[model samples]
Target: MVRITNTIDIDASTQQVYAALRALDAYPTWLRHSTVYRGTKMRTPQSGKSLSYEDSTMVGRMRGEVVEDVPDHALQFHQRKPSGSLDALIRYEVSAAGTGTHLTRVGELTTHGMLHIVQPILLRMAAAESERTMKSLKAHVEGHPI
Candidate 1:
């Protein structure tokens, strides 16, 4: 398994940051991945709620569920292959920082199956991607266009 954690301070209130992070519909505006939905219905994030999503990323298309959504505090999701291989776990933690908001993201990737062969390379890529994503989140919450 590979784990990567990144933290960023955004110039916004925790409430503002939390709201923006929960706005799944606005992901494409800041997130590099183009999200595609498998189901027509969309719901807000909440504990035990699962949302299916397909996102185009550097590693290609990934399908995942956004689970364990703790309002204003944390969000977590698990990505798995159609064959049932656990690919990754992405988590977000938010808190008040001074007069702004502090966001921390943790990404854990399982090195099972064929992924073990390229684990090192994949780990580096995941770290870089996490940094990029945090920067994008900062920009998005600071009223800047990503």
Candidate 2:
């Protein structure tokens, strides 16, 4: 198991940040390695909803379920590979920071089979990608290009 956590302060209100997080369709624009959903479109973040999508950095198409959803507060997703070789949980928490919003992202990944041999490298990559994504999210919310 590996865990990666990142936090970023967005120069926007909590509502604005939350709205942006819920906009799954725009993920490919700022999120590194993200791709469009293939099965069903995610209109909004709601508990029990499932999304099937593919990411460039992932092994294959992944299916994720919304485990928890609190508007303007927190959102959590649990994803797993189709073959059950990999599983991950991603969580986003938002809070008021001065006049802006403080967003924290936490990711945990577990691997099986041959993936265990390179777990350390995968964890490092996840951390780096997460940092990049944070910068992009901040830039996007602040109306600038990353």
Candidate 3:
């Protein structure tokens, strides 16, 4: 498993930022116009809620789930290929920073079988992806002016 962390401070309250994160749909779509569908009955991103997504990107098809959700604090989501090729766990942490919100994202990805050979390259790619996602979130939360 490899880990990458990205942080950004948004000019919004922790609750607001957290709400936007939980909203999911508010975040701008990226990488092949992937659409996320929540398969759980709960409206809130509580634990055990699954988000299944099919992206024509690198992974092709993947299954995702919410492992943790703490209002105004943190949210953790996990995704992986059904064939056990690629696995990623994403966690977002939010805190109050000078009346604004400090958001941190931790991304961990593990590659298996044939993919394991290219894990280093994939790590770098995932790191760039993490940065892009965080920037998009910051921009979206800041009214698209950032």
Per-residue error for 44 in candidate 3, Å, reads 14
Per lDDT, the best of the predicted structures is 2
For model 1, residues 1-146, the per-residue Cα lDDT tens digits are 77899999999998888888777667766776522222222344456557666555545556777777888898887776565434889999999999998899999888666667777877877787778778888988898876
Per-residue lDDT over 19-111 for candidate 2, one digit per residue giving the tens place of the 0 to 100 score: 887776677776655432223234344565454334434565666766777999998878777788878898999999999999999999999
- Listed per candidate, the RMSD to the true structure in angstroms reads 4.2, 3.8, 4.6
Give the TM-score comparing model 1 with the true structure, all chains together.
0.82
**lDDT of the candidates, in the order given:** 0.74, 0.77, 0.73
Candidate 2 pairs with clashing backbones: none
Q: TM-scores, in order shown?
A: 0.82, 0.84, 0.81
lDDT of 3 by residue, 1-146 (tens): 88999999999999888987787544434211322221222234446545433323464656666678888999998878889999989999999999899999999888999989988887877787678767767777777754
Question: Which model, 1 or 2, shows the larger lDDT?
Answer: 2
Ranking by lDDT: 2, 1, 3
Number of the top candidate by TM-score? 2
Off by over 4 Å in 3: 28-56
